[model samples]
Target: MEINRKIRSKKLSTRVDLTAMVSVSFLLIIFFMLVGELSKPKIMDLTLPNSCDISCGPIGCFKANRFYTILLDDNNKIITYFGLLELPIQSPKELQYGKNGIRKELFYINKKVREYSASIGKPNNGVIVIIKPSKKSNYANLVDILDEMKIANIDSYSIVDYYTPEETKLLAMK
Candidate 1:
């Protein structure tokens, strides 16, 4: 009496098809991947180089015999160039100094550069422009200023630390 001879398939075994589930999971992964890529914020990275180990002191105060120096200060200001304060800086949109007053600021500054070139019996065309961006200054502004400087025929350039104590003493004179 123990064994029921044949249990006529009395139970319905349910099996779930995982194909659709797998497809849905893949789609979700793709969506998140693309969204994460597109939603990323655009950021500007500025890496201040460690290559500028050379000390700029009173020696840098005077333009090198073959080098033209343009100083970039903390305020994104192009201060003191070729032994003069406020070396000509033209504005971005103006053709003449004091005209539209935008482009000429840099043009005027470059004019001073040319004058310095002539005074020193140099070509002034491929001069070296020194960048002294303050630790607190805006990097974008520095880049903009450098772009303008390049437009002004100053092709070669450098970045140096400003105000080495003795250098400050010299700058204080004017």
Candidate 2:
């Protein structure tokens, strides 16, 4: 006997609602942004002058009493002179590389500069450092001296290429 059979097929919808997923993603992004904003980085602020300023003129314009020159040579030998480069009045003081070495000297010199500025009724502009790296001086010594400057809180410093005869003589004096 042939029996009639009824077949029923149910259609399922493939479309999905993505509103919840989109909202969760936005929340995660905002959470990360807030966390990033809360954690701030600590850094030292160094104010470098404009390189293209023509009015800067020469280093001679800087205060002579506040000028300090550091000469680096081979064997990690550092010679520091305080005074005007134009005058050979002060002798170069030989110093080692350490806290008790150049750092102490710098502190005393800076104190003197401050006192001088106070006497002159001018602001303490700090010392102007002239770093002259000789051919015998290696890159490490130069970097060490620069680090010392930062530790000393030196505000004004410049690397000069030319070496004066007086400086050469001072270096030769052992």
Candidate 3:
């Protein structure tokens, strides 16, 4: 009699189905990209003054008495004066960088300019700040002054790189 033999076959798969994994990974990547795009930083809009040499028509030229100049020097020193340097309404004075320093002066000067303008029948006209950042001044100093402008609610301001001979001499002193 012949003996009957039973044969067993083994099955094995070397490939894995990665469709779900790939789809999930793509979904995650898209989600993170959207989140990053949505979280972008908001920038402040800076409106510079017109480049009119003689006079500005609709905007009107800023009077010397209504102008305020802040000079940024090395070591974060701030030199501020009201009106033109030649005939300053308030003489140039060194001020520290903070609330009690530049901030206070800005508030006082703004109030004074507004009052003066109102008295002169130009209630809408206000203080105009001119920021002169010297080569020696750091970027942080400029940024700080800009922040102070915002905090002071100054609507009209400009950053001028050119310095007058008198201003250069002023920065050199102390």
Off by over 4 Å in 1: 1-68, 84-125, 166-174
List the global CA lDDT of all models: 0.50, 0.78, 0.87
- lDDT for 46 in candidate 3 is 71
Q: On residues 53-137, what C-alpha lDDT tens digit does candidate 2 reach at each position?
A: 1133455443466678899988999998887556633677899999999888887777777787888886655666778999999
Q: Judged by TM-score relative to the true structure, which candidate is superior, 1 or 3?
A: 3
Q: After TM-score superposition, what is the CA distance of residue 105 in candidate 2 from its true location, in Å?
A: 0.8
Assess the local accuracy of residue 164 in candidate 1 as a C-alpha lDDT between 0 and 100.
52
How displaced is residue 119 in candidate 1, in Å? Answer: 9.2
Q: Between prediction 1 and prediction 3, which has the larger lDDT?
A: 3
TM-score, per-candidate, Cα-based: 0.39, 0.67, 0.75
* lDDT of prediction 3: 0.87
